[model samples]
Target: MSGFACASSCGLIFKSKESERNVVSLFQYDGLRAVESIRLGAIRCDPKSSISTSAAKCGRIKAMASPTVSAPKREKDPKKRIVITGMGLVSVFGNDIDMFYNKLLEGVSGISPIDRFDASEFSVRFAGQIRNFSSKGYIDGKNDRRLDDCWRYCLVAGKRALEDASLGQEVLETMDRTRIGVLVGSGMGGITAFSNGVEALIQKGYKKITPFFIPYSITNMGSALLAIDTGLMGPNYSISTACATANYCFYAAANHIRRGEADIMVAGGTEAAVIPTGVGGFIACRALSQRNDEPERASRPWDKDRDGFVIGEGSGVLIMESLEHATKRGANIIAEYLGGAVTCDAHHMTDPRSDGLGVSSCIIKSLEDAGVAPEEVNYVNAHATSTLAGDLAEVNAIKKVFKNTSEIKMNGTKSMTGHGLGAAGGLEAIATIKAITTGWLHPTINQHNLEPEVTIDTVPNVKKQHEVNVGISNSFGFGGHNSVVAFAPFKP
Candidate 1:
């Protein structure tokens, strides 16, 4: 008995020359020509067999070695890697970063009745409104008095971030001012200023409009003013992707550092949209929660009783720098900006895709960009705005990427802070990084009755102590914009 072997995934072995010859003859047919070619190229027929043809190339087949699979390329070079040196925010909890995160971990609700203006007439009367926010030290008296609250929030938050980064007046003098940039964004830019200008023009005359109205009311003004104050000449701009604005800013800012355009970037978002027109606008769209009776529970995400999202106002900012620059200056590295991604649903204007394909894809792409495996992510700061369609839609999207939800502890920071629109991602990112540093995951408060479809451990109504390996902060905006940003503890 002579042996023959074919090894190109056919994995066939024949014990007799007659059997091999018969198979070869069969494969030689017109319909099986491709198969015959593969077999001829990969097979070893018995050497002494008379039926073995030269065309068969009867030689021992060497098994093809599997390609060596290596790990994905992550940013290891100090110049390319981005680190979060400092964080600052103008949150309803307060302007202090620690205080803001502590308030969240304590499960405190910042939502309350909108007392900024008379809201008794509006259908939705409550929101995550910041009370008595002062920009005494950050902005001068003249500018503070004239600037819109949106601009004030941006200025305060941006300056505070610089202070947190140890980039103070004295320290900044030593660094390259030209290599620094600002990218703070706002979704609804200076609505108060715009509203006041419009009212002035309508009620009084066009001459009554303030000269500063146009400059302060524009979205790019925040970033421009911040850059002007700091003397930064690098890439300075604003992004307005609704609620995903902050994450988009983060992504863009990190890219600036990665591309060697800037060594440090003051990036995040701010929005003070709790004014009359702001509230009236959302009310017109029917997006605000009407839970005026229970303001504390108004932003309940993933809860079956959730009605709609609570509109909040504030700013959240981060100081991102290249690792080389940070380490050279002995800067305090708070966390590593692993990577992030943005995707558009291209489906609806205000509503997320019920199937959640866009969000799931965004999450997946973010991991790939971060050079992180799905299993590495242990915590998710979800954009679970308590709207009926949005909450379950985000949960469904999350379930698609993470197969085992047991290890993943997800929570919605918006559950307590309410949705900050343009500032939401930045605030949530601070929460995520805090969770990484503190090993404490904040609760998705007001989860009294969870939606049946939400299977992930939401850390419902109570914070949990979990060592986070990798955490992601998600933020989705109107116009079908979805963003996911990954953060991890700095290893080096």
Candidate 2:
């Protein structure tokens, strides 16, 4: 006979062979007992065995027993939500988000001659240049000269976004500063600073180089400066994924809030790579357009005669906050970040996957994360940088994911603003948010003739307003990185 443990009112009992061997007590619990009742084979308890009789017969006993119960699961509080409260941008197309959107909707192109530096001998002379921006106004005069142009752009964008969100000095002083964070990204951080340092070392010697060169060139300094300026102590860092940098940064910020790490995050990207070396490098790779005479028509995405991207520089920033935080502070929520995804082509270091497999997977994954159906996306801000392979690859990827729904309205903002490289994702994100809020979708200017193999509907020439519930933005860059972001109108 074997033994089994049971809860008895008074004591423990063992029912094996009564006179066979010494009784062995199994285990004990408060007010319960281990009772063994023989039935068949090795040992078993009779179903109708009386606990009172068994306990009375056996000598093993214990005190009162407590009931076995499992701990209750912690319920997730649904009160917290993420919302975009404000946006700011400094683009080749315009300085403010609204101005940029208006210019895009009017189909205005910002590409022009490379006057920022001497690009006369370069194969690609045209670029989208930001005009008349004074960083000294944003940064203190004493510190303005110490920072690289990229950091200056980020500071301006961050300050504007905070102001737009009405997160004034008074508001910031009243909040938990430690719960606020900053996440800024750059594909080519401080390239200008590095180039300048190299030039100084070659021409004037090591003593000519500035002591601030290292800090200015490092990617994380921008975020650090923004944090210092705004007093945000929460999770602060910089993400670098080439062209996918900004989108990945925003994705990281959103996850931080979701995981209860931070209540607010200032996230975006900045780039100031329009100098001679920047343009010459892209020209060497034949990745930039050479249409100097008609600079405005240089970036023509989806057009059969398209040549290459027009290098541009700027910054785009958004004030992202938890729904609970915004609601408690009575902040105006602009839009909600539904979801985003990132992937690697891995097929090539520079070229996209020939079959667009990675790009398609990224799009589908983003939709899945957003809890959105393919058919629900009414507009897509394509990363069509006007490069022959890049534009067609993205088109093919969209065709693969959307299939029958590939006919959805698509616009390439690069056509007007030029490709801002690392900052493209953030700039395009701001455009997407504006599209949802204002109901105005911009057009792909200079797309004179659409390619037959490219199946997606390209919005060309004229701006139009349509009821858009959901939208997506895509950005892909060198090193085979791809990222997609999904946005939807705010419900609450």
Candidate 3:
């Protein structure tokens, strides 16, 4: 049997004798020559190659003009791997990562009555108000006082994340500072400053506005200030896509490494919008929950009794480094940032598209970019904001792409932290990565009644033990901006 030639695929057997040499020799011929050679008789095929079943009837092997199987070879990525080494955030829960996640794990609500100002007249009087906030170590006291809370949040979060990644001033001095970058941003940058400036201008005239007003009130200042502080000469800027701002910054920052542009990036979002103006604007749009009576139970995504989102305020920043750079520095890696994608609904200003096409496509593209299969993702950090239209729309979009029905478990972390506006993605990304590291899914606190639209398990009310090898965090904005980031537990 070993001496005999065979077409294992088509089950054709040919003897190794000289009488069958015509068939054995054809295996080495070019496609056309093979076809001609096979016509002589006793067709044989290499065991490694496939032969059509029609060979029995035709008594000959077909040949091709080309050498390959027809698909074009994919070019390999030559750049370094991008990873999340450290993350830092100031949330209503706390500044510590363990404290922030443990609170959510216990299913505790961070939402409370807005303590930053008198929100009594506003329709929504409560929020995830950040408390005992200070930027003393991260920013100079004089500069901290001069800048708006948004800038302070950005600087504090950015510096803290760098320190967490061991890229502090001392470590940075030893490396190429120009190869690092910053991309922190806020949806409504310096809203507090802008609101105060406007109020002063209206009451006492333009002269009442401070000289530092314009520089501090712009949307780009968050990224600008971080770059100025870190001296990162590489790609540095802020991108505003409302709530999707964090994911957008993350996506762009990862690409900067993948494209060989930067070795490290400080990316994510920060915002302090618990003020009178921020709450008032959302109240005017009726986008805030009216469940002021029970502040703890307000931000209930996928709940039948849910009304709207509870406004959350704070900052979440991450230090992203190319694997080469992080490995060389011997940094502690937290997670692997696999891939991400962005899409626009282009249907409405503040409403999502009814068809759910934008979000579905975005998820598919993100998975494709990550080289991940849909079934491989056992966990999903939903973007459900507790709004009537928004929550269901996201559920439907998720349903469209994930068809395993019950294998995937989705959770609404907003049910605890509320919606963090532009910083939501950053906050949620941390939650997702923590789940990957801890093997625990933080519960959706206020899910008293799950909606029919949610067929996937929400892991409601209490923390559940689950393995999170791969996961995604979703973030969508009022302007129909949809962004998703794919991540996994660090393996190398």
Candidate 4:
């Protein structure tokens, strides 16, 4: 007979009517203890039977008169609700949000030969490299020249996001700056600056290294710079969990608003890791697709011929505000930030767990936190990086949480933008919001041969007109960091 024990110092077991061979016990305790004693096929009692009678047989336990009760389900408070008011990005497609998503819908390939530096010696020679990015009126000439691309991207995106939120310089002067914050993060911050510093230290001396080396090279600098530029004194910080960095930032930023710590936040991620060192590091790990001949088709997520992820660089930022604050200010709402969660695989540094338990748990928690049912999620912006193990592993995890694949449509933004490392989740979140607003789901391009294991309708190779009820963006990173953020149209 199967036996079960209550996780309490006063352990007890009781059999139910459902199964004669199985025992069940339910109790609440302030602290947990290992079940040292288990009664197998002990006293048989109906669930409707008096609790006092069962406790009398179990011994040394005073049973409460109340039946086992579950915790009350949480409901979202409108005042504490957070909404997306603005989205800004610096992508290979362009800085314009609508234009960028339009390019995605068209199945345009941003991947091209790496022309920023001489990549002839490298095994992988292509990326979703941004071409002719200009800060123009955003930053002055002197600072722009010295700033690392990571900081530059962060500053521009953050400022533009504020502008989109109608919180531009003129509006900001009237509001309390203390209630505004920035939480942009990065996976590999200021790669170019760090690489240059190391090169200088080796080739010449420490004297040759620039003064801004340490300040610019850290992961927190993007948030720091944005906060500095905007004079925001609220909960400003950065979280770096590899590719899951942006979603982690989003989760934390939303919580800050919910907790009344801040009224608004500039939150997301930035990456400038397409430099020589960044490329070399991924190449060393054999984590890059080496399709030099057909660079455009390199990032083929869920495709049988996919080799590895292609590297990309960009920044994606969102202006998130408390619904009450946004309503009072007459701000334009794009989408609602329902909720998000973060989990770790606790298995491997570079590889995901084969069973995908951690990822599935993360998705479940995100839905629970969002107060959303599994069936409500009709769209998923997957973290399919085109790696052999990652693609199928994520698919397996997705299948566990979302039982009905027929209702759900999934796509990989990395298919066109490549893996943006820390910035991937933020960029994909923008795409998910666009899908919600436009009633169109962009295609997961380069699906010439679909992987047999991936059963979900991937919107293969062409955009589809699907109204997204609720969307969740998945972003997993090295060191087994898994993150999921949920969003939907703001319904009053």
lDDT of 3 by residue, 1-492 (tens): 110110000001112344255655211211000001111223233444322232111111221222332322211342456789989888888787889998888788999888678777777889888889877778887898889988888887888888889888888888897789888878888887888889999999998899888888888899899888877787889988888889989999989888888999899988877888778776665567889899999989889898778888778998888887888778898988888899987865565665777788889888888877776677899988887666777777777776653556689988989888888888998999999888777878788787765667787775666677579999887566789999987776
Instruction: List runs of model 4 lying over 4 Å from the truth.
Output: 1-75
Which 10-residue window in model 4 sums to the lowest lDDT?
Answer: 1-10
Encode model 4's per-residue lDDT on 100-127: one tens digit a residue. Answer: 9998988889999999999999999999
**Deviating ranges (above 4 Å) for candidate 3:** 1-78
lDDT of 1 at 279: 81
| TM per candidate | 0.85, 0.83, 0.84, 0.85
TM-score of 4: 0.85
Q: Write model 2 residue lDDT over 1-492, tens digit each, in one string.
A: 000000110111222452236543232112111122112222133445332322211111111112342322211233345789989888876577778898887788888887887777777888888888876556898788677888989998888899899987678888898999999988888888888898999999999998887778878888999999888899999987777778888888988888899988999998888887778766665567778889999989878888777888899998888888888888899998887898887754555655667888999988877777776676898888877656766766777776554326689898988888778888999999998888767779998898666655575776655456678998876666788888878886
Q: CA shift at 368, candidate 2, in angstroms?
A: 1.4
Model 1 regions lying over 4 Å from their true place: 1-71
Q: Which residue pairs in candidate 3 have backbone atoms (N, alpha carbon, C) closer than 3 angstroms, thus clashing?
A: none
Clashing pairs in 1: none
Least accurate stretch of 10 residues (summed lDDT) in model 2?
1-10
